[model samples]
Target: MSLNFDPQWLSRYPAQEPVGGAVSSCVFCGIACGDVEAHVLAETADTLCFLDHLPATYGHVLVVPKQHFQDLLDIPEESFQHVMATAKQVANALRDSCGASGINLVHATGQAAHQTVFHFHVHVVPRYDGDSIVVFPRLADPTRKHEVAQRLRTALNAPQPPKTEAESSQA
Candidate 1:
């Protein structure tokens, strides 16, 4: 190996998938089951958080439920709360320790929506000004949002999806 350093050297290295040669069939399941190696930051009865192997930004973290759930549609109330609370804790640390200007608490549900991993996980991405990365997220226009709202409202009434922590606790 040459002693000379190149800032672009890291880019030349191919990204490793889910920490490489995971023991379980499902990568995240391997992590959750402690069959895969990771720099685990936090672990709770229902959740586990660790640094991303291929981070989108500095201090990027992936928070996941220890119990397997492919997507948001089936996550139970308590498990969901554990993931959300853990994400909040990681986000605050990024702001306080890493000087993040903002944060994106991102979750993708399906493959078409860009959910690459089938296991449910939340990305607590830290952002800084002048940073090239963008989640490219936007909100619906308030005027037109009612159309979207009505569609969700109808779906909300019908059920295959379960309730969230707040929803279940309130009932």
Candidate 2:
């Protein structure tokens, strides 16, 4: 058993700390802490909006909490609400500035949900008419929609799963 936290020493002993699916050396966390550089757009007490390093469109933005929330599941409701509001602002700025055809606020929660970045962030992707990117292709109606909706509605109406101590305190 040994301890190694040297950033430069990572080349010799590559390792990482995983905290509830969150990487301690997360790039977004560095950016949040001002340890990394980013083209900042807007910042609030709880959230930060910035241009995506790899833009899907011209004004693609990423809205994230200043705190290191691993994903949507880890963020508090108030922080999540603020993040959504910041995303909306970014979307409106994109639309008003460039007359965007549409905008997609994408939040990939878990690894299974295609979340590459462990940090909780909403991608404000702007859409333009005739843009090469196919935001959403037309798809045939799903089978058993009504049946699934009824099942989901019934599930939604059922009592929620018991909360943990942390969640109960959050409430």
lDDT per residue for candidate 1 within 15-52, as digits (tens), equals: 32332234256677888887899889988888899998
Model 2, span 11-100: residue lDDT tens: 442223335755557878888878889999889998998888877788989999988887777788998999999999888999999789
Model 2 segments beyond 4 Å from truth? 1-23, 137-141, 162-165
| Candidate 2 local Cα displacement, residue 143, angstroms | 1.4
Scanning candidate 1 in windows of ten residues, the lowest lDDT window is 14-23
CA RMSD (A), model 1? 9.3
Cα lDDT of all candidates, in order? 0.79, 0.79
* Steric clashes per prediction: 0, 0
Cα misplacement distance, residue 100 of candidate 1 (Å): 1.1
Task: Point out where model 1 deviates above 4 Å.
Answer: 1-24, 137-146, 157-171
Worst 10 residues of 2 by lDDT: 6-15
